[model samples]
Target: MGELFNRFHATRRNRRRFWLSILIFSSTVLFLFLVFFVKRHEQKSLSYSQVEPDSCVRLHEVSGVYRIRSERNRGRIWFATAQGLYELDTLRNQWQRFGPDQGLGSDKVYDVAFIDEIPWAVTRRGCNRYNAKRGRFEMVAPGSKLDRAPLILIEEMEPEGVFFGVDGGELYRLASLQAKPERIPIPDGNDDARITCLKKIGEMLYIGIENGWLYAYDPRNGSFHRYVFGRPLSPHAYLWDVVLFKGNLWVATSENGLYRQEQTGEDTLKPVKGFPAKGAFAFALEEDGFWCGTPFGLWRYHARQDAWIQFVHPREKQPTDFQVLTLFNEKDRLWFGSLENGCGYLNKRNLEWVTAFPSLSRPNAAALAADDSLVWVGFGYQGGFTNAYSSDALQKIKAYEASDDILEQSIQCFTLSNHRLFYGGYEGFGYLNMATGEYDHYSARRFPEIADITDIAVSPSQGLYYLAGAFGVVAYYADKDSLASFSETRRYRTTALYAEGDTLWAGTLSHGVLVIDRKSGQLLARMDGVSSRVMGLFGRPDNPDLLLATKEKGCYRLQKSTLRMESVDIPDKVLPGGCQQYENNIMTAKGMGNLFWVGTRFRGAVVYDENIRQWKRVTSQQGLLGNQIRAFAQSDRYIWIGTYGGVTRFHKPYLSRLLDIVL
Candidate 1:
């Protein structure tokens, strides 16, 4: 009986073991499936997060490169990336960036061009023209009409009109100041063909289509002719750029080396010898030689010898090489813009080689400003110092000699007018003479203790200059503008000051917007709808509405006398338009011609077209530093930017879609 019981127990035990094994196997399978699902979700989330940076964007320090450019003045370079449009600055081998929060038309600038001496920036939609007169942007047209979406390629027709190239290969021109744009026919044979390049040489309009076919149009006779390259190199001949140099037309292609056709010959193009290895992506004509910035590096064409000399910057180890896409000659030095890398600089006299600030990555600076007299760079900052560069040439001028305890050596804003140098910075206010280098401080006990002075504006109507700071708004008499601080009777942390006739508009950090009577230090009208942290203030010279950049609520268009406020919608993708910085929105405003450049803290910068009511953002893809902009200033030649990374400067319109696809 005992043996029979033992056998039954063993059988039961074996069954139990079999069931346990099955359970374990099922559990392990489930666990593996769960892990795989979680990983897939994480990857999707990471990609989505990259699509839009968090409100509090943190910039990581990468690397640095020494950039030396002989050119002193190019316009402030504007860049567009997957993130936004940015004003980059490069100084002391550092990089920085400025975007929407600071002040720009939009956060996505695809291309930029200069028309009527004004900058016209392209976006996904239409185009915007900078109105330097009113200090704002005026959209040339609404972009909604093009069924093609905003992938626009814009170029200037020299003195006046502008040319727009759509993705479908249709060309349109904003020839007149009419409300709507005019569409120009590209001749019947081209079909709805895509235009690869458009250039105006002397009196002829040159258009390049897919494959190696070139066409020339005589606007006077309405005659069109196609120039064919004898051999077929590119499946679709794509012309990238065309320029008139050395009595000949230099044509750059996507597959073939540089092609040249005599100005008199309408149908002949021969490849320039030395650049045989690669096709030209972008090129700039300097004195006698042509500087070719190909996908490889920088190449100089010696017209005398008819040869190409590739130039690369000197670095400690093997310097980072990139596809040079653009070139600018500042003060005789050469600056190259890379499509993937950043910018490159070569000092011909010193043979000093350098790249854009934060040179390790895509700090591509699209524009350049250069002059024999001065060099101004705009970029971001990496470690400590901001990326605003002032050439040793300008530093030698000794604008202000206030060698004595100059109110905070850190300069926030600087302006030179009528031979007088004005600086607004951490200290209070100061003035210096370019000739004498005599400097004086204006922050004394007489005025309420002011923290950092952010901005100083000289009234166009009145000679008086308005001082804005952390304290309150203060006005100093024009002629007696010495280092004497105003009496402490009035103190307000003012960030911006604008004047119209006798009325002065002030945007403060804590006190809302104040309209002060310039003559008397008394406040006239004050608006407190939003907070006192008014960042950007622009008084439309003709319109009664005042444009105010606020801290949280995007931008406000305040009615002149009524104080009625209207909120402007910032792009959903970009929030807190400026960098999500805890400090006061360190944005700036400058107007040249008809365009207004608004520098922001985080959103980088945007160009606003008051006429079209459009916005454009500049970003790193377009060759800006990063997106954290600190300040914006326009020198006689280039627009300057102060940022967290370093400094970057561009000489032309910058638009690169690759930045959006990449991080």
Candidate 2:
């Protein structure tokens, strides 16, 4: 009986083993099938993202302009815009922009001048001379005496010389292109005084000072004379412009209106009648009379009637609100640069207004975000509206202006979470519910500490959002509808934030980067030595490593395992014509599959392909709207670039294919 029992137990054990083997085989097959299905689905989706070659890159819209420079002899007009320098092609009716990528010293051109038929531009950093043969702006006196100084104005002197004014009220004269700039001593120079404008009439050079004084320098005799309006020592006055109109010296001032003085007489300065009492910024000489630009509008001084007539916009019905900053007169038109309204031209014969180049309305593109269906772009200060574009139809764009509900007009950064769009701007943080089409805003009025929102990061697993700005870092609990700050984030000037698994990275203005343990709210690591001001941190879409972008240190990659930072090598060809230092001027960096994209404040955008180890650049020459890239976003099919000029879309697959063919 014992033997029979053992036989029955063995048979039952064998049957149990067979059933376990069958179960294991079925589970393995199911897992394999799921993996295959997912891979195939990804391939199908990628194929759908491919676009045609003709639609590889397209410009959607243009931003408003700030200043205008005309070269009537060449039949070209140069626009000194926030984007860069744009030359209007009258024959084609198109605008061509030049930036660092196009070989300019910098993209932020404050003033432009043509001396000896050569175009020269003065940037906040230094001065650049345009090379017509090479079609690029070459830096003048780089790392020399003229370097590392903020140039405010540039004007041609008598005979064949140019004068440049530094922000510190020092004046330098360039006798020729090959000659070194010689310092021209100011009589009783005040270090606090700044040179605003310079004009030359006959043998005299008229220099306008922000201290409300106009200096008349006789270049031939080396004599200096100062002219003052109001009190001789009035500190409230500011001289904006100096010009010669109808053999009379005309001066525009910030405190007083317009002043006119005869060339030969008692030289008594008299204020022009029927002009704005304040904020007279610029002037232009006309045949019949003179043109004055003020805060109110453009005014024409009729010589025959001695009466003033204000030119109003046909559409607005009110006087043109363009705060004209500079003026240029052509044979038949008057060009005026505005403080916010881009630039305008008036027909001299009919006294009609012409909207030459409409302002981008929003000058600085601050933040960019995109999903599968739409792209959202935010602007910086004075940027009147936020722009949106449909991913499927990029030509269709919409603008969101500030209203009673939307208090913030300047957006600094944006993020997407829970099917909603969240933005941080001049005032505070806000969110738009995509499903409900509802808008909700929060500002310093509610949370006084949260002002000047610069960057944002969302934690999906923890159901929280992180905001970084002037006040450091703050946490928003979506469930609790509350904002709080952690001890680790205090006392740090954080400008940007990024979230990863179990860790949050905070980019500071001067302290480098701070890595914190999200769960414990404790600082884990402080990554220094990358840059003084870290602009952004991004993770590679295909890899676990991280990239850090900075203001002057270029870009660096942080290894996930070792956390060691390594500098990424940028191709020299990406920025030709002595613009190699511009690699460190990176503002934003993003990664996709095997390509890394970088955006700069001046040098447009660059894409590095990891597969073939190549770099490709896009600027105005390559059909981009502008070269000053403020923000960048990538969808599955397209890469969106937010520039000072407008929003540009690039088809990823087509670009990749084109690069392959070129390489």
The regions of model 2 sitting more than 4 angstroms off are 1-67, 158-160, 230-234, 314-320, 348-352, 358-639, 643-663
Error of 1 at 487 (Å): 50
**Per-residue lDDT of candidate 1, residues 1-663 (tens digit):** 899999999999999999999999999999999999999788656643343221112122223111112212444444443333333343433233323322333344556555645666565545666666764556566553432246447766644466777767777766566645666777655647887776677877788877566888665665777775655657865787787886777788877777887455657777766675467766677778777766566677888887878676453233335566556566646766565454556888887876443321222221112233443222221111222224321221211112345323455665555555666656456665545756666654444444476667786344577677766766656676532233432566677777787787888776678887766666777787776467768766787787877664557788987888987665545434343354324355554333445666555766566666666656443334566665554434334444555344332221113122110
The digit string of per-residue lDDT tens for model 2 on 252-282 reads: 8886787777444335567766665465877
lDDT of 1 at 66: 14
lDDT of 2 at 123: 75
Candidate 2 — which pairs collide?
Answer: 63-359, 63-360, 63-645, 64-359, 64-360, 65-342, 65-359
User: Quick one: best lDDT, which candidate?
Assistant: 2
